[model samples]
Target: MAVIPVAIAGAPYEVRIEAGLLARAGEHCRPFLRKNRVAIVTDENVAAEWQAPVTASFDAVGIASDWLILPPGESTKGWEQLARVVDWLLALEVERKDNIVALGGGVIGDLTGFAASMVKRGCGFIQIPTTLLAQVDSSVGGKTAINTPAGKNLVGAFHQPSLVLADPLALDTLPLRDTRAGYAEVVKYGLIDDAPFFEWCEANGAKLLAGDSAARETAIAKSVAAKARIVAADEKETAGIRALLNLGHTFGHALEAETGFSDRLLHGEGVALGMVLAARFSARQGLMSGQDAGRIVAHMEAVGLPSSLKALGLDCSGRRLSDHMLHDKKMDAGTLPFLLLRGIGETFLAKDVDLNEVAAFLDEELRG
Candidate 1:
């Protein structure tokens, strides 16, 4: 097992990554399992595959377990589901000290963490992420949120988990497309600040996706380490350094919004295409070389991820995509800060950017 430490402001924790780690969750989380009652939040799909092993693990530790399974999808991250989870926890009589186990993917982790943050002032929680996206990105950070009708992650909190138990074996049951989609974020870390890692990804990522155990472990460990370093430096995203983590998120989220946050465009797919656009936009502004933009697109295509809006079969022009950006949470005082690139492994936030020009750029891309 590889352990990566995430140092947040008030609370610091470690992310434990290994194949078959789920069977040892109770042992890994022994310190936090003070109360005998444990509430597990998961989706139906995950419960069907992982519930038995996790329950047996708890049983070994003599802890009683109760489960709340929500339907799997972005649509489930709403007030209705949040209310149901909260009520379920209440029905279980969960105490502030008893820990809630988030036993599925990002959606489950976000919703359950938000619920733990709200009910009766707050409670303990652990993240047992099943998906590659959740393991490398969402599960480690304290940014838990549920999607609102207005936009993605509009309602949420910084409820850091007491522990994060990531079992890569859970990913075995994931669809191949889902696995490849999650690799987009894994590649994001390399794009932001590590050129060498980016090159390594271009070479070994295919093997990792092909189920090479060594390759998978290396990718997860490296990605987690990079995220941990960033979180430790800027836990609350107050410093611009942390915003680099949003390298592809701004444009990606807009794409998600345009697609109605459906499976049509997975979050990772949006990020993959967004990173390509960020590179192209930077090159257009003379901030980066066109060669770098081409390289970005090539790498994304190599991984079977989307590199352009057109590639996703979306007929909307860049202007239409820009319209979706108007609702982005990053917009402040009517100005949106964009993370643009100067080269591979080099990105800087452009706070003075004009959205009108961005719209024009998108228009140009669409027309071409």
Candidate 2:
């Protein structure tokens, strides 16, 4: 087991990574609970696979697990389900000191955490992220939100979890496509600042995706540690440090919105494509060399992630897609901050990016 500490001021926590941590969840969570009963929030898909093992683990410790299984998908992370989760927790009489468990992918974690943040003003929650994307990205961070009609994660809060249990074995149940999508976020940490890690990914990403246990553990630990340092330094993103984490997010979110945030494009898949677009766009702006951008494209394509705009088969214009970005949370003074690469592992936030230029670039890509 590997433990990564997120030193958020006044809310320090640990992310515990292991292969079979999910089956022993009760042992880890017993310390945080004030009662023998706990509330667990998950989606139907995860509940179908894991509800039995997790409940049996809790039952062994004389704890009762009360579950509220939501319908799975990005749509679940909205105002309606948020209200339902909050009402369920309130009905369970969960107090601020009580810790609820979020036992699925990002959707469950985000919704439950947002619910916890507002329940009686605030309560604690544990994250047992069942998907690769959640384990590597969403679970550890205090950022929690539901998507609104305006934008993704537009309505949310910074509510940190008490403890996070990320079991790589959980990914064993995930579809290969989903796993590869989550791998995009793993690659993001390297692209943001760690050149060596990026090289390691180039060499071993296939192994990790092929179910190499050690490689999975190493990747998850390194990714979590990178995020831990960033979150600790700039928890609220008031400082520009945490903004680096949004490397492919702006473009990715716009793509997601264009796809209507459905299974047609997974969040990680969009990010993989977004990172490629960021690289190509950086090359276009003379910020990075075409050779370096080609390397990103090659790596993404090697891993079976989407690497081109034309391949997405979107019927909309580049201006239509860029229009979706106008509502992005990163917008400031009518300009959106873009994460662009100077080279591999050399990412910087460009504050003066013109959406018109971005639209024109997208038009070029779409035409290609």
Candidate 3:
């Protein structure tokens, strides 16, 4: 087991990456088991596979849990589910001091954390992220959100988890598609600040997805530590430091919006293509070599990730796509900051981006 500390101001937390932690979840959660009961919010898919081991673990420690399972999908991250989660927690009488357990993927963790944030103004929550994407990114960051008709994650909160138990073994059950999606975010950490880590991912991502326990653990630990350090420095994204984490999010979110935030493109898939776009766009701006941009795209392709806008088969104009950026939460002072790369491991925020130019670029990409 490895512990990565997130030193968020006024609320510190730890992310535990280990194998088989699910079976012993109760032991680790004992210290925070204030009510001898926990409210768990998960999706049907996760419950079907993991509910038994998780429930048995908590039951073994004499901790009771009120389980709320919703349908599994990106669509579940919305107002309806958010309301459902809040009502369930309220019915369970979960107090502000009580900790809710988020036991699933990113959608579950985000919705549950958002629910915990609003219920009684703020209840604690623990993350037992069962997916690779959730384990390395959504579960550790305090950023919890639900999507609205307006945009993805437009309605959300920054509710930090009191404890995060990331069991790589949980990923063993993930479908190859989901595992590949999660690997996109894992690669994001390397692109944002660690060139060597990116190289490591390019080499070992396949093995990790193939259920290499050692590779999985190493990726999770490294990714969590990078996120922990970034979250600690700028938890609220006030100083733009945390914005580094959004390396591929802008382009990815636009792709998500284009796809109606559906199964057509998973969040991490959009990010995979988004990072490629960011890299290519950086080259467009003369900040980097086209060869470097190609390298980024090549890596994604080799790893079975969507590597270009052309590959997604969307029927939309670049202007229409760039229009979605207008709704991005990162827009500030009437301009959105594009996270562009000077090269792998060197990402910077470009606040001077012209949406019109972005529209033109997207149009070209569509034509390509």
Best by lDDT: 2
Any residue pairs clashing in model 1, and if so which? none
Better of 1 and 3 by lDDT: 3
lDDT of 1 by residue, 1-368 (tens): 89888878678888989898998877777779877768899999999998899888888888878888889988888999999999999888888888899998889989999999988899989999999899888887788898887889887888889999988888889998888888998999989999999999999989988888888888889998999999889877878788898888888998898899999999888898889889998999999999989988998888799886665666787777887877777777887889999899998889988777888887776665
What's the lDDT for all of these models?
A: 0.87, 0.94, 0.91
Candidate 1: segments with Cα more than 4 A from true spot: none
The lDDT of model 1 is: 0.87
**For every model in order, what is the number of clashing pairs?**
0, 0, 0
Pick by TM-score: 1 or 3, better one:
3
For candidate 3, lDDT tens digit of each residue in 1-368?
Answer: 89989998889988998999998988899899787887788899999998888889889999987789899999999999899999988998889998989999999999999999999999999999999999999998799999988898888889999999999989878899999999999999999989999999988988998899999999999999999999898999999899999998999999999998989999999999999989988899899889889989999999899987877788999999899999999988888999998888999888998888889999989888
- Model 2, position 313: C-alpha lDDT score: 91
**lDDT per residue (tens digit) for residues 311-351 in model 2:** 99989888998999999998878888999999988999999
Ranking the candidates on TM-score from highest down gives: 2, 3, 1
Cα misplacement distance, residue 287 of candidate 2 (Å) = 0.6
